[model samples]
Target chain A: MRKSMRITMILLMFLLFLLFLLFLSGCGDKIDLEEAAVPLAAGIDLDENNKLRFYVSNPVFGDKSNDVQQYNIPVTSLRESRSLQDAYTSGALEGRNYQVYVVGRKLLQHEDWFKILDVIFRDARNTVLDRMVAFDGPVEEMFAVKPKEQPPLPAILRGMVDSKSKRGTTVLTTLQDMHRQIYEEGLTPVLSEVDYDSKQKSFRLLGTALLTHKGKYAASLGYQESVLLNLLKKKATKGVNLSFAIPGEPNADVFELDRASFGIRKIKTKIVSSYSDNRFRFRVQMKVSAALTEQLFKYDIQKHADILEAQLTQQMQDQLEKLIRKFQRNRIDPVGFGIYARAYQYQHFKPLEEEWGEVFSHAEVDFDVHVKIISMGTIR
Target chain B: MNQLEKHSLSFLQFVFIIAGIQISIAVLSTPREVSLIAGTDGWITIIIGWLITSIPSFVVFKIMQRSSEGTILDLLRKKLGRWIAILFTLIMAVYLGAMAYIGLLRTLLIIRVWLLQNTSPFVVLLLLFIPTYIVAREGPKLLGRYAEVIFYFLFWLPLVYLLPMKQGRWLNLIPIAKEGWGPILSAVPGVLFAYTGFSVAFFLYPHLTNKQYAGVGILLANTITMATNLLIAIVCFMYFSPNEMVEINQPVITVLKTIQFKFVERIEVIFISLYIGIYSLVWIPCLYYMAYCLNWVRNGSGERKYLIGLLILIGIGTYIFIPTFNQSDWLEHHLTNFGIVVEYILPIAIWICLVINERMRQEGQPG
Candidate 1:
């Protein structure tokens, strides 16, 4: 009797396992990739009526027409917007292949606009590594313009930001990166910026947008300035080509070369912060190993390399000092000077955590730049 | 079944059983809870909590050494009356049952959120019990083997956490102890919840083959628990900024979302699914002890019958009342508080009583 009971129990368990698998196969939201609307990119902006405008671009494959289908809706939350888009699309909308999330300047201006993104960070299904791009105008306008030669807006936008970041012209920001920066007390957030050029009827890669922890837009950096920001933030190392006119010479203007260009072979930045006399002082020293990539004027390479290096060093020092003053004037630390202070001088920085921006503006800063032209090209 | 000593556990088995029981569902949320209180100073708090929990564990080991009884129930039956022994056994059976139930519920909750969103919790709970019953019914010796095998199988989990460190910021841990020692000390009680499974030493000591090394084994178990919690907390602390850490429900698991391979996406889903193996370590032992407690109440009779009965009871109990996430959290909150009394306080009290009684009885015998 006991042996038969044991046998019956084993059979019952085995049968139950089979039934569980079948039930699971039939239960829940069963979706096939072929019928699903996989969004490649999402654009969010504030419409003219002050409503939230969400744009989703889904790339169609194997059909050859309607190559990229777009959806536009005005919703209050990301979750609602996604569900509403799913209704209009042919199949359920999914973001597993999502590559980009763009926000417009008007929406970023609102201090609480980041509150709408709670669903993105909270949902386990959403991707956190997707590129986060901030645009100068309506995101819809950028999404409306299809890529002329590239596959679609998602790949084109991603490539634009990535290439610029490689050359140190912009900072590549992702959802996780922004989340960290916004939450960290010692650092502020910055996103790669793009602008829609109506005349050119194309999208251009703007430099970067500096934002507060609350996601409010504070200031912007141009392409040349973003290189300096990236270097100081330690986000980029090589491939930054610096082009500036020689000081005191309006334009040597040799041939068609506009300015001298130096391709950075190596670069290093060191920051030392100390507290003294009821104030904080910071010293920023930069060392650069550069190759003379392009020269506007005919100069002797062997005889004038030292003179060129000295001149570039002085010019870079002045530029860096001016940039520091600009950040001070704006009362922002996009270069993460506050992080250095808090890291190296915690005793003095712990009390002033909330007022770090104001304290940073009042602090004294010094700059030193050293440049060595390691290679002057094959010609010179 | 022929000779009880044949079912005894080696020192290594004893250590893994303690380590396995200590490292279940609690490790997932420990980073979040510690971060909420102590911020980045959580790693330090984990070590301190480890040292504090070792105190009760040491006392329990001492009690086991002083008594040569086959189990704590036998010790209690000799010192106290049979009724008192049975009463304590019932209490322990209820406590272990509740703990196993909570662990099983939390595992199903995580699976639902991450992997099987559409599967009913009842079905998932039942499915979890199959492997659990298979391993647990063989007694502690086989349970020890299962723990050993699972340990080797899942040893790579901690290394997987290092993948997310590429994007982590070391600066998040700076200004250490910024809130002073007040927060770290206060968070110690919270950290002790993660170390509660060490109480299993009280029951496992009689089954130890080499009792001389049991002390070292339990200490090693505590050290493993400490290291696991410390590694997990520090990883989450460095991966997410202080403010973001607070916002996340389980930074340890959520941080895994960023790790993607060329062929696979959503690795956390795969991890949460495979984590069923580790989660079983909790319920299997707890269920085994609950069954043991029931058999002790019957003076060590009908062990298998009692094990099957308690398993069915747990299944029916879970099915009748499935806890929502909030309710499950509420249960864990109460369990942590109740567990401290049972896991730490009750053992120490029993140790003190045993010591005094032994001293008084010795004095009378000498006279």
Candidate 2:
């Protein structure tokens, strides 16, 4: 009896193993690589008739005709457009591999435009690590401009924005970061801006698109102002080169220009928050250590370093003050002064937290900058 | 029926058995749950929660110390009455079964959502029961070994959660106590529920090779649990902004979604799949205790029949009437409350009765 029971137990184990192999190897939801349509980039734009247009650029595999297969359709929902897009594409649309989400300026003009991208953050399978970019023109025209010598538009655009962002010429805004910016009262959203020029047949990397707290397009910052913004935000710790025109340049040629460039080795920014009178007051202190990279006009540096440093400090202060005034004019706090205020002064800032942008517009801010030339470039 | 069941668990096994059970489904969502009540000060609630649980934990140890050779049922039958012992056994048997049942269903729901979406949950439960039958049939001895193996095996998993904090904002933790102590204290009771499984020490103390170190063992288990909870909570707070902490659901796992590498991506999926080992640590032992309670009522042998019957019943019952995710959440809500009554309230109540009974016996003997 014992031998028979032992034999039966082994047979039962085999049966269970067979059952596992049968049911556990799922055929119901498995999608092979060829069957999945992985979108490299997705664009959201509002058409002239106020209809939402969704665009996805999917990489085509094993097809010699073209490397990328583009699809666009007018739809009310992003997920719903996948079914609509199936009319032209062979594979199932998957958002798992999305590398970028491009939002047009036209859609960004609306106050509630950010609510549409909720699906990306809500879904468990979808990724939110992709860059969030803003287009200055209609997104449809961008799809039309395909350079013959370059890779697909999505790859080119991702590479360009990534490199530029590294060089501190543009902002790199991920979907996760954008989500925080939209909901966080302390700061506003800033997307890396791009504009396609039809005559030049090229895409231009415009610095950064500034949005109000409600995600509406407030203003645009050029490359230089974006660098200044980067300095204040302390994002560019390295590779920050500033070109300033010095007064001591001698006219050597008909097209002689007085210019000096320096690479920043280190920068320290401090914001002091104090509330007095009718408006909140802020004292901005910055110390910049730089290495002189190029100089067109000759001057003795060792003896009069203080005067040169003072002059550079004055120029940087005026530029920073102008940027702060511009932010105040637009009622935007891209420098995250409100973040510091909430962190350092929570009790006083609680009542005004809802409309901090308006409160900040009337606030007083003074900039104090000091520049020190730490080193000069070595000549071979 | 069982001769060699004595001296089954060493000191290390005893400590790990309690710690493994404490890190159940609660660890995954504790950050979001506590932040909902305490805001950015959620981590402070964990310290207070540990202190509160430490009281009930001591009471449980005292009750177990009164009868080190047997379960609380044996002590009740000897000191009180058969009626009281039967009642306690029935209540605990049902409570333990329900906890194990709900824990299994919750694990299945998590697996279906995160790991296997298309596979049948029935199949998943059946497959889960195979290993459960293997470990639970022999009772606490095997359960102790399972705990030790799992605790050491997955020791590095929690360390993986620490990597993402390199980008976390330490300033989010600054200007602490923004909302005052009221909300932080309110979140304490909720965190106390996560520390509930230490109550399993009632059954485990008898199997211990050294009853003298039982107190030290329980304290070590609680410390291990506290350290794990504090680590995950602090990481979630430091990595996510205060606003983002409240917005994201299951920030523990969802935070890992952003972690990327050149070789492998979507590390959370792999993390969840491997987390199945830790999830099994909760239910397998509880199922054994449920069967043990039934054997205690019968006053019979530690036969394998009881465990086999309970396992088959659960495997088939769940297949016939599948539990949905929402139902599992509802079950979890009631289970935590029921666990507090059993793990927290019952020990203190029983200890009072034992004290009164012992005092009456002394008076009858001397006077």
Per-residue lDDT tens digits for candidate 1, residues A1-380, read 99969966995987678587757553577789788888889888999999999998998877574489887899988888877898889888875557888999999988867778787777676677788999998877787887666568888788898789988999988887887787777777899999988788677898999887677888888888898888888777788888776655445445444467898888988888888988889998889999988887767869878888888898778877888788788677887777778767888887887777778889899988899999988886
For candidate 2 chain B, the 10 contiguous residues with the lowest summed lDDT are: B1-10
Clashes of each: 0, 0
Candidate 1 docking category?
A: acceptable
Using alpha carbons, what is the TM-score of model 1?
0.93
Model 2 agreement with the true structure over A20-107: per-residue lDDT tens digits: 6756565476778888888798899999998999888887777553477776789998777768887777876766667788999899
Candidate 2, B239-265: lDDT as tens digits: 777777888867888878878776776
Measured with C-alpha atoms, the lDDT of residue B149 in candidate 1 is 87
Total residue pair clashes for candidate 2: 0
Model 1 chain B: weakest 10-residue lDDT segment is: B1-10
Could you give me the TM-score of model 2 versus the true structure?
Answer: 0.93
Give the local distance difference test score of model 2.
0.82
Model 1 stretches astray by more than 4 angstroms: A1-5, A8-14, A17-26, A95-97, A197-202, A248-260, A263-266, A277-279, A295-307, A344-352, A373-379, B67-69, B79-84
Error of 2 at B9 (Å): 1.9
